[model samples]
Target: MSARSLASPQSAGEQKKKLADSLIKKFNKKFNGPLNNPHLSSIIVAEVGKLLQKAKISPGDLEQVEAKISREAVSESSAVLRNEDVRLRKIKAEMSSKGGLPAALLSKEDRKILPKELKKTIASPKKKPAARVSVNMLENTVRARNAQLDKQKAKHTSVFSSLGMVGPATPDSDAGNILVGAKSLPLDQAVDPWSVLIMHDVKKYEDERKQREEQKRLQREQWKRELDDQVKINERKKKEAAMEEVKYAEEEQDQLRVADIQEKKKKEAKMMINTKLKEERAKTVAELQEQKRRQLEEQKEEEKSEVRRMEAEIARAERRQQRKREEEAERAKRLQEENKEQRKMREEERKKKHRMDLEYAASQARMLDDLERRRLEALGKIKEKMKTIEVMGDTLGHSILEKEEEDERRAEMWRQAYEKKQLKVCFFRVCWCRGACNVCVEAVRDRGGEMEKVN
Candidate 1:
């Protein structure tokens, strides 16, 4: 071991010794600790915790030193025992050969039996039994618990049975045993499984059959009652409907006679209004045609005046061109050799200027070509834009048509609603007229009766 580990209080070896000593001490004190010490498990755990705390170690640290202390303890005990055995054997040999202090040594039987027993104890392996709960014991405990519950249930059931009330219960094997025990019959007969099963099946079938018959009888009676009720209702509804139809027909005929007379008067008025409107439309058309003829004559006279002005302008332009050529020829003859040297210099400048002009003309041609190319590209983009605009216009027109159709549909719906309202008004008017006619008829009948009595 390193000096540092040996010297340190919290080292592995020291921690193991502390843990083992603490365990041994707890065991020595009747397996009790500072607490009530009810069990060995708690004591061992407490000792382990206390030693680990003192050594500043963890359970993981204990793993390395777990077997060390136990192994050392065993070896220490075996060495002490071996030394004692050698001393004893030497003393026995001395007693045999020299007869020195024979009384101080053990007798032959004690010596042989002690060594043989010790050898046997040392040679035999120590068994570390695995701790487990016994399955048979657990099963017995469960069975006893079940029996207790069954007894309590039986007691409660017996009390309720006397009062003719029973709680719900599920059948199990134990229930049959209980029934057999309660019944006063021979054990063999009462415990017969087949007899129990047959009785259960018979009762089930009888109950089910009784329920089915009761249900079917109730359903047949309900159906017959419903059929009778429906027939009576149909007869009553038919009588009410026929009376209403007859009353409605009488009222409709009277209204139709009144509507016919009123319609004839309205048609005569509409025809007179339509003739007036047609006459007014024809007068406006004739006025518009006269104004158009006057405007066409004015436009023809203005065109003739413009043509005359254009012809005068063409004659003036031709005369100006003739004068310009005459002026150029006279100026050239007068200034021809007035500065011959200067003229030569002027000629050289003229040649350079002409070359420059030629170069400028070539550049202008290239620029014109570039402009033409740009114009072509622009024309293509304009065509594309036109196509897009056309499509957009078509879509806009379609949307407008759809909107107009929707507006028309809404207007038609409104017209239908107005017509329905008018029909309702007419129906109410007809009902009012019917009520007045009934009152008048009753009065007339009373007058006729009075006249007969007077006569």
Candidate 2:
């Protein structure tokens, strides 16, 4: 039987031991460190052993617990790493969003809200409108002209009064004159209510024009402030982007190093596994060869045993045949002696029977002779009667003659029938006697032959 067939199934402890051994080998080959550093395999193995001993756990249960812990640890670690990667990626995206080109470096197309035409207009340099003519100066010039007109009118009214050529002036006329004067005077100097209303309208118009110019000036200043802020923000973003690029390059280098290490470890592991498989296959082949040799030996022994058994059986069969032949010879001798006495008695009986048959044959021959003589005498009597009938047939009438002839013929026929019957009986009796004599003679000859053999 094979060792595997003889042994029980491997226990958890044994499996664990095998796993540990494999792990130790893998670690010894995989770990790369300072020459003075302790081997990773020894440290890991010792730590795990110490932990398991402290737990005082059974191997079977420990295996299950270890497997569960390993799965959970791997899952948790992977989840954490995945979350960290996601967070880092989100931060990188935010940083990229914050970083942008400064206005000085940006193209018109890059401006988010500004149209190309507007950007061009803004870029083109133009002289500021020389400080807008102040509305107050225009108001002052209008007041001075109104004062000179009022003075010339007053002087002309006085000269007309002195010449006494004044016509009847009613109150209505005076009111009309005051209205005309109010229309020409400045708002501050005017006494008429209409003059004040007209002056209020002129001032309101001037104030509205000044308000529009101030709004335009404020808009220009706001645009300048926004552009400055944008430039500062762009500069900051550029600096941050440069820093991020350097950080990303360093991370990529680290990842490449890690990947190279992992690849080397995988190659080493694959080589170790291949070597182990080859060793196992060779060991299995040797075991199979051993089993085959054992089977061949067993077959050869069985064949030799079978040959011995067959030879023994053949010998027994031959002996049985020899014994059977000897028994048959003895029985045949006894039967021969018994047959000798039987043959003597049979000879005596056959001789007596032959004598009786001879006597019977002699009597039968005498009887046959007697019957022949009687038959011949009857035929002679029949012939004589036929001659007599023939003689009487001539004397009788023709009919009577015919009757006699028929009678005679009938009588002759009857006589001939009787002779034939008697001859047949005699012939049969003679044949029977001859046959009995022949049988007795043959029996007597056979007995004589047996007697000679016995002598």
Candidate 3:
């Protein structure tokens, strides 16, 4: 039982190792090998150079170090090229021996040999220092001046403490005189002009250092971003490969299913063909028998139909004769009815004509009566006007010639009015009469002209 337990663990480890090896092989094949970013190596070399410069290494030492590094790199590259196959075998053997240890559990040298992107994930990233607060150059100058002043004051105090006499009442040197004057002024104005240059140089150096630090920070961030991008690209490629594999598997399954369905369809088609052939044959025999039977039945039916056709023809002839007789009798009756309707219509037309003639006569009589009455009334009105004119002439003592002229004028007006009235009556009559002759229109026009002349 102890042996079995030990063997089981070994077997499980072997299985895991096999699984890991297969997975690694698949990953290598899918990725077409590990990443080889030339830029990353160049950046690392540049960073090393920057650190060496920061260390203030001598030019001779730098040259020697560079030469050694170059020789090593060339030798290492050649060795790697020469031992690639051996290296692969060794790696396989190691993996087999290790029994499924992960890449992270490998040694530091092994981790260094891994891809840069993978190394980033296997190792913890260094935490960047917080950025330093920037001080204004004027503020720094003021602070430096204050510190120098404080140190000078402390020295003076110490010197005075050691002396038996009190401090000097006034300064004698030019610097002492300037300091005495500066002491009376503000701190900003009291700044030593000589120190400005030193402060400026120090500020310049600080700015350069900050700038270099910022540049290094930016480069690091950019490198990290590029690494992240590479990782993402690898992940996307892996996903795409997995999807393609699934698609290929599904396509293979579909091809197999299609083949199976085609085979089944071919088998079913053969069965259906055989069944159709038998059915067709049986149907042909049955159809031949039915055809003979239908032919005999058709012959008997044709004979009966012939007899029935003769009887139907005789009956149709008799029906046609009877229909013709009935049609003739009905047509005669209809003609007699139409003649009666025509006679009644003629009588109605004649009566309508008589009524119309009477209505026309009555209208004509009414028109004539209205014309006569208007004429009589006009004449009476003219006579009354004439009599009034005659009376006026007599009352005003008019002469016979004036009265005669007045009488002539009155007669002319009466004649014009009468002619205008006659013309209007003629125009109305012409309008009332349908299709009035042109002669009547011309006469009325002539009367209108004459009346207009008189007016």
Whole-model Cα lDDT of every candidate shown, in order: 0.45, 0.45, 0.46
Structure candidate 1, residue pairs in collision: none
Report the alpha-carbon TM-score of model 3 versus the true structure: 0.21
Tens-digit per-residue lDDT, 1-455, candidate 2:
12232233557568456655764454333321111124333454664465334323443333333333323322332343344344434433443465422222233223332223324434432332222223344565557655764665565552223212233333322323433322333334435433454577668756865875675566445544554454454455445435544553564466456546756865886687578658866976896699679868966885686587976677576775687589669867876886687688657856865886687557645744663464345335434533553454343333334544654564465345435653212111222122233332333353453211110
Residues 209-233 of candidate 1 have per-residue lDDT tens digits of: 5875675466445433433453454
Better of 2 and 3 by lDDT: 3
Top candidate by TM-score = 2
Q: Order the candidates by TM-score, highest first — what do you get?
A: 2, 3, 1
Q: Per-residue lDDT tens digits of candidate 3, residues 1-455?
A: 12233234456656444633553343223221222224334433453445334323333343333333333333333333334334434544565465433443455434433344444443433332322222344466556655765666665652222112134532321234333322244334444643665666568767866975675566445544543454455455445445544553564466456546756865885687578658856975886698679758966885686587976677576785687589669967976896687688667856865886687557645744663464345335434533653464353332334434644564465346546665233332222121133333454566664211110
- TM-score for each predicted model, relative to the true structure: 0.17, 0.23, 0.21
Candidate 3 Cα misplacement greater than 4 A, ranges = 1-201, 204-214, 217-232, 235-259, 262-455
Model 1 TM-score relative to the real fold: 0.17
- Candidate order by lDDT, highest to lowest? 3, 2, 1
